[model samples]
Target chain A: MVRHFMAALQKHKMCYALILPTFFLVFLFRYYPAFSGVYHSFFEWDGALLEEWVGFSNYIEAFQDAKLWRSFLVVIVFISANIVKMIPAIIVALLIFHLKSEKHQYLYRVLFVVPMIIPQIVYMLLWKFFYEPNIGLLNQLLIGLGIVEPDLPPMWLADPEWVIPSLIFMGFPWVGVVSVLIFLAGLQSIPNSVYEAADLDGCGILKRCVTIEVPLIMSQIRLSLVLMIIATLKGFERILIMCNEFGGPNGAANVPGLYMFRMAFMEGRVGYACALGMLLFGVILVLTLLNDKYVRVEK
Target chain B: MSAAPKWKNVQQELAKHAGILFVLFFAFFPLYIMLQASLKDNAQFGNNIWLPMAPYHWANWLTGWLAIKDFIANTVIVCVFGVLLTLAFSITTAYVFARYKFPGSNVLFYMLLAVMMMVNVASLVPLFTLLRDLGMLNSLISLILLSIANGQVMCVYVMKNFIEDIPKDLFDATSIDGATDLQVVRSVVIPMSGSIISTLAILRFIATWNDFVMPMLIMRDEQMYTLGVGLMSLNSGYDTQWGPLMAAYCIASIPLVIIFIFTMRLFVKGLSSGAVKG
Candidate 1:
């Protein structure tokens, strides 16, 4: 049995030997942190140091916090709004696939994905300008076109009701660009003959897309959806830049991630923020599970 | 010309121009606004919509630069080194996964995959404490190390996909000639995988360069700040030196810009590969 084991090891020595860097690195950083995060969640550690073991009290406090609940509500709204914005990317992907020429498909892709190449924070700055109320472009165009009366320009960021929607619009163009790029790639992978056969079968573009293109690209779409969800949930810089706080007006944009930032840095409630982090982690994990169910890698 | 051919030609010309026009408009619009805002005379900015200002030669970028040189340097050091170390670890790890199967390898690989699902936000507090306990606070190494470590999943994902695409027969032929795993990786694997590795490096570089939070949390001193944090400090108009601040922003973004311009093909390639799951 021992000789058999030695021979087996010799046969695959390289494989075992080759992966040590990744295993060691991941074990050091990711798994270690993940386990520690779970342990820390229960311990009631303030930012300064680990407090005496508090068990589920932190979790209970997390459940009871009214602000936390409000932040949770805001997260749901944020996620839904992001779903709305992601539609354009799906459409763009479909259109790119529909293009008769591969060259043209590449052309539009380069254009669409340009926004993503700029870092998220830089994009945030551009949107903040877009929402600038007194001298911003949107209202100027609205008044110029007689869409709104000259005397009444809508407040883009000032009023609490418009805050979340405005922020949502700012983030809309981003995912569409990146997702389109992903979906177009998936579209390309559907062997040409498959599409040619569909065409020979007398299926039109829209019909073929619904029946064929959608199924093949479903994995990519699901991935994009999950990504966009987590992105909106964990959004930080844009909110910080715009509101100059966790949320801009009346806690309207105050999702948990933003609230955690405020709790940690602004309010110095380190333990509460750690609890918020775990809650955010759980919520995201649930959504990710949903993502995995819908988007299988092997399919 | 026949009517069919004539019609086809006309439609093609129209579509071509229309796409270019749309692309140019969207691509250049925000940049135009950024440029205009950066250039407006003081009177033009505070009193009115900052537009139609003089076009200065990267003056805003210059303003950004002077305002945040030490900060930009700090960011550059952390990001450049962070990206390099990440590439070092990820490439070898990916190569191993692609080429060999060993005991518990599958388990380790999937754990890495599962880790990708845990967004960075979730682990920030624990990661902060870990850094503190390790006495990595306010250190440049802390940011670089964390950035490198954080990318364990992404790098593995990219590298694994690229390496898997290479056929096994090639590896066997090389192995029969007495090539070691390191030898094969150094010579055969790395050469064949040049395009993908280059692609991964570029993507990793951009990710680390733009990272805000890790550096924000880890680096203690003002001089240790990266571009993202440094830019934020400048954005407050603390120095109000708009020229240098803009300059610094331009400086910070230039490496990415140059890489984006040159290796756009690889960027698109990475996107497409990610689309093709497994």
Candidate 2:
């Protein structure tokens, strides 16, 4: 048996060869650092470890953190905005589906997804310029359109009450494209016969849309919702660049990802940051699992 | 509904198209604004929200963003090396995970997958300190290693899935013909997975080329900045010079646009087809 085992090892020496580099890479980055993070989370990890074992103190401090809860609320607000904006994405996707030809669909797809290719920081910066109070494009446009009096233009992003709404507006433009692209894909999967039958029933456009389209697109909807929630929760680069710490103008634009970054990296509370990181991880994980459960493959 | 007249249909179609047009405007407006903002002078940009009165098309494109011609070289170095290294490591790693039945492979693979959920921000605190300790604080090598290391997960997962679908006979026949495992991989597996490799290459190229945080944190030296970080710094000391920033943003995107012009169809198909396969 020992000889056979040795022979087996010899026969598959090449297999071990294939895996060794992968092990090295993972060891250096993912596996080592993950344990490092957990280990760091236990003690007061500064540049020096001190290797102190203050069990569960990090977790308690993170839980009690007022900023952490603030981040949570801000993230929830962003997610809720994503949910609201998803409706138009579906409508747009459905419109693309019912188009007369593939050319139109292709054109629409290319145009809509353009914003996706633009860097997040760049896009967010553009919105920041637009978010600036008096000379911003939004206020100027509103005034130009006679939507608001010249003097009565609202201060957004700068005002605490208006920051969330301003962010939602900025984010909404960037996100709907993905939702539309995903929905367009889902629409393609649905058989044409469902629509054919609906048409034969003498059903109006509204009825067919409600019955045939919405049900067929539920999987896409679930996926979009989950992706959006993850995205909104994962908000950082844009908000950070746009608002500049303190979540800008009374912490309205703060989310878990950005706030955790501020706390851990900026403030040097490494243990507390890890706990918050773990919470962020938990949020994404829970949502993804829920999405999988709800959005099962529909034949 | 079946008895509806053609004229009414046209009216409703116009409405839908109008709505779509409205959405398209929203979609394209920011980019248009950026383009316009690039052309305007610093003072003019701060004063106005829209296009400048005089079409300084050349000046707008020239004055601010164009001066960073030096950065293009640094960005190219990082992206080229980064993409090549990613491909090299990911292809082999993915092949191993997909074909070999080694001890602890599953556990290790799952651990890598877990790390994917931890975005770059999560690694910020320790990573900076770690790099500073190692004296790798402002090197391109740090960017290359970190990107390749972080990128291995998705590429490996995707590549493994692609390789799994190849016929087992191909590998078996190669081995039967006196080819070694490495020989089989080089001659058989990779050749057969052209589409997947091309797709992974494009995705990695774009991602690393545009990534901000990692490069920003690591490459603090003025001479060593990637295009992403360099562009951010363009506006930093100068009090957010929109003209130059805008110029730089547009100029930076041109390479991608030019590349996509040639491989646009393949690029679209690559993403779409991969999603379908997944």
Write down the worst ten-residue block by lDDT for model 1 chain A: A170-179
CAPRI-style class, candidate 2: acceptable
CA lDDT of each prediction against the hidden true structure: 0.71, 0.73
* Residues A44-123, model 1: lDDT tens digits: 56667547677878789989889889988887887887777776666667666666677876776676656656655565
Fraction of the real A/B interface contacts present in each candidate?
0.42, 0.32
Q: Measured against the native two-chain assembly using Cα atoms, what DockQ does each of the candidate structures obtain, in the order listed?
A: 0.47, 0.46
lDDT (Cα, tens digit) per residue for candidate 2, span B200-269: 7767777787778777767767888877677767656645666767887788777666666666666565
TM, chain A, every candidate: 0.83, 0.89
The C-alpha stretches of model 1 lying farther than 4 A from their native spots are A1-20, A139-155, A193-212, A294-298, B1-24, B46-52, B55-61, B238-248, B275-278
> Best candidate per lDDT, number?
2
Q: What TM-score, to 2 decimal places, does chain A of model 2 have?
A: 0.89
